[model samples]
Target: MAYRSQIRGEFIRRYSECKAAYLETSWRMIHERDVKHRALNTEFGYPEPDGSFGIGCKSSVDQEYKRRYDEIESRFRKPYDDQLPALHRWALENSMSVYECLLMDDIWDDDLKALAKLSTMEEDWQFQPIIAKARFMVARWKEEHVVGEIQRRVKIESSHFHYAAARCRNLLGLKPWDLAAQKAIFDYGKEWKSALEFAFGSLTAA
Candidate 1:
């Protein structure tokens, strides 16, 4: 019985140690995430007068604009400060594990599967690389879907039958008055315009 008690006490001690380590690591992770968020905002000039990273069209010479921009930027630069603490509280209330919370938040992906496995074993393991990779994936996703869709719409809206004909004539090294160029232009213009119109409607509906 004494031996069993000693073993049980040892188990309890180890469990306490693991819990403490996990909590410390989680707090550190939260801090690191906040630091990273601030760094990204700074790098992008987020909350700038024009827009994040000065993406807005406001002129720099306008004193009023600059003043408003400065005020807005200051307000938005620490956008996540309040939310981070709330997130921690929510996780605690829900009795969610860190990994479970991360998965629920859609922060982890298949690429981090290995890191996730390691995370279960080692509380102090840094997942910065995985987080960086996830950020890159999000950027690529935006480029492929959001930016690509916008570009496609712009092309369809700006293109005309005449432009297609002109392009064909140029490619064939034919003058504007050439019979072949005129025929190609006529056929291509009709086909291209119809196709583009259909695509435009479909994209608009989507």
Candidate 2:
């Protein structure tokens, strides 16, 4: 059966792909703007209408600066803008359904929103309970399964060791003086010791 974690992993993979595209475009825009902005400052001799020249300086050249910045941004942004329709199309076509999305973690809300907008899905406000329920269920099932497995293995190990020890003793008729019989019986004890260790050690370490 498919677990919530497995489904969430798949969603994160697709969400990451969409996020990378958004980040790459944003980074390119910011980098180009910074480079051109510095050049603009130099071209205008770093004008300062307020008589200050460091960060947050206002300049008399504001209009010209805006014009140039807009030009640079528009040039870099056109390709991304053009591709948005196709991006949205892909997001809608391949994005997880709302049911599958309910299995996702809330930590992914921001990324999920970006993809959800592209896919035209409801935002977090509309589906808050989905994530809450998903988180609760995943936690519940994890606790149940882990505890159940540990209990089960412990019982099996105990039962097998008890039966093996008794059977070995019964077959021996009396305590064996020979090394072969001694080795044979001790082997079962060694094997069950390992099994018991494994049963308890299966728990997560703090």
Candidate 3:
């Protein structure tokens, strides 16, 4: 019995090591792809007026950027699409789901939620509670990390101001005045104030 316990402990340790290695490799690949994508976007002058590429006409620069973006995106997706099935199978063999495995690896709850959607793991009743928990965890995380940081940087950019206020509005369903006064203490000029008024008006109308 003692030998069996020792062997079980060793197996657990090895499994944890393998899981950590897999997560590290996967995250590194993703991070590298993101960096490349951002660099390519900078080269192509992304976030055109319409928030899309080829605003005026498809220049060679635009085409090259698009090609690189597509390539990187494809490479990023390949591991998830190709390896996920095998991973899922392994998880199932261990009486777990891929979502469970990701959770065990301490992946962000939002990412797990996305994976759950992509994998169509919603069909399982067991997965529903995990999804709910993930949502709660994400909200708590955003409240703790994102909301506070954005509030601090509200004066840095109009986008940051809008994003911080929007988070409060969307997450907590607070009124714009309350969100602006409490979360984002920004002294908006006429344009932003007018825009916010229009946005709030539209929301109230809707």
Candidate 4:
């Protein structure tokens, strides 16, 4: 397998950067926005924004999350639109479930096209350099999907094992043994895929 050193280097850098971002995601980042909505508002009504602060009674907070979810999803589509589909198919066939497929329906047909366009891309992307491209796709889509899930999870969602592929990057690389050295460097960060994994993992387990 032939690999472009520059592309491979870019992949390695991207992988490490994404991993660092994942690690940087603190509990504060996850919940602060929700908490601030509660603090800044001053209303009266059962669980109304500025009304109630309790977890169960906050309809305003629920609506806020819904709005944030919509915005987040719209942003997520840009990346999803670019992610490679063959990698998605590979992960889906190997470990993903039907619920995952359903949950992953693009917010619109454009997202669907993003997932399907791979079949007809240029030859190198479609066939000759599949594994290398798949590596790129797995990493690419993994980020897109993870960011999407961070904002929401429905009854239906898909499983993600791209990190498994990420780990097997060596086997998936250009040479039999001369795989990119960054694979080892980025291995731990790839576990962030587990967050995306468990999001859909429960879909199959159920």
Candidate 5:
């Protein structure tokens, strides 16, 4: 959440400040999330969303940011209100369809939009619920991707050959064993299994 807040909070500074180091550092962390996001690709019945941690979350967040982006663009090309509702409705409808989105898609969308509105109105000063959603999304997404990435990693790279323990540490998900069986037990745990694999690395049968 700290990282996320840094990214969003520093948005204006990111664009205007010549010496903004927070955005740079925060981006580095987001790259790590990109690597780990591979794990959650198949778990949710679809692949991971393309883009950084900011874009890796639900589509509502994407749409919310899309609106922000549009508003930014409107600084040069503002559109009339007549078309706003239609566009918003279209985005809301496709933002995260039940056919593709979570079970609580509406709830999540509401929370995200409310937070975005609050942040914009408060200009990053009044930040309570905004921080909460930020934390929730990052922690939840990271937890999910860990297990999936590990299972995929182990199958493609697992070997008896000795690799540097430290270098191999990042690939902890690359366990050595029946990936199916390991996944079966881990399946029930979802994010928990992901956390374990992330911590343990390459599950081995031996």
Candidate 6:
């Protein structure tokens, strides 16, 4: 296995390359389809956008368009979708967490530094990293998927941070949140304070 950061970088690079290839293929297929449509319209005397045509000829053109659309999707898109599973498997084999694989780019740089600091800090050894990681995950969750009114309220409620953090910590098989854990994460340093401002709306509280 390679260094973890190297593995991560490679995964992102390959994934981006795959996406770029798919987009290029898709655009080429679309252009080809458009040219074919224009040629068909000329050959069959199908009506232009501003012209009228017989219902029978229009129906024939619609069927031809559908067939070409399906052909392009299968030929240009399915291979890219199939390649995605292999990339996911590589990420799993390298011991990268789901969060690391999916949201690594989305995580703020300062929050990453705060997590690094918590990992190395000796003071409040047990709670420092755990609470911070859990809370950050909760924050990211809200950012990613908070779409409904209930979810919005849950994200902003005064006590919801503790509740969400505690639940996330439990899912990771860690102890519950407490005042000490909170302080250790938010009050330890500027890195953590910045992270807290990100997780919650501001630095006021969490």
* Per-candidate TM-score against the hidden true structure: 0.23, 0.37, 0.34, 0.23, 0.18, 0.36
Per-residue lDDT of candidate 2, residues 1-206 (tens digit):
21222234445446657656866776777676667666666666675666434222235468887677566667767765656455445544664432233223222545455434433344323333233332333344446577667556456644555455444344333265655445544553454354445434444433
Q: What TM-score does candidate 4 reach?
A: 0.23
Q: Taking the candidates one at a time, how many backbone clashes does each contain?
A: 4, 0, 0, 3, 8, 0
Per lDDT, what order, best first? 2, 6, 3, 1, 4, 5
Better of 4 and 5 by lDDT: 4
Which lDDT tens digits does candidate 3 get at residues 84-203?
455444544654322233233434434444443433443322233323333444344445565445333323433444553444344333455674334222432223333433433343
Ranking by TM-score: 2, 6, 3, 1, 4, 5
Comparison by lDDT, 3 against 6, better one: 6
Model 4 residue pairs with clashes: 43-50, 100-157, 100-158
Task: Evaluate residue 150 in candidate 6 and report its C-alpha lDDT on the 0 to 100 scale.
Answer: 29
In model 1, the worst 10-residue window by lDDT is: 1-10
What's model 4's overall lDDT? 0.37
How high is the lDDT of residue 87 in model 6? 45
**lDDT by residue (tens digit), candidate 5, 46-101:** 34355323323333445554454444334423222234344334434433221111
In model 2, state the lDDT of residue 195.
Answer: 40
What are the lDDT scores of the predictions, listed in order?
A: 0.43, 0.48, 0.44, 0.37, 0.36, 0.45
Candidate number that wins on TM-score, 4 or 6: 6
Clashing pairs in 2: none
Scored by lDDT, model 5 comes in at 0.36
* C-alpha positional error of residue 51 in candidate 3 after TM-score superposition, expressed in Å: 12
Q: lDDT per residue, candidate 4, 128-167, as tens digits?
A: 2223232333444446676455324421222333433343
* Count of backbone collisions in candidate 2: 0
lDDT of 3 at 31: 79
On lDDT, the candidate that comes out on top is 2
Cα RMSD of predicted structure 1? 24.3
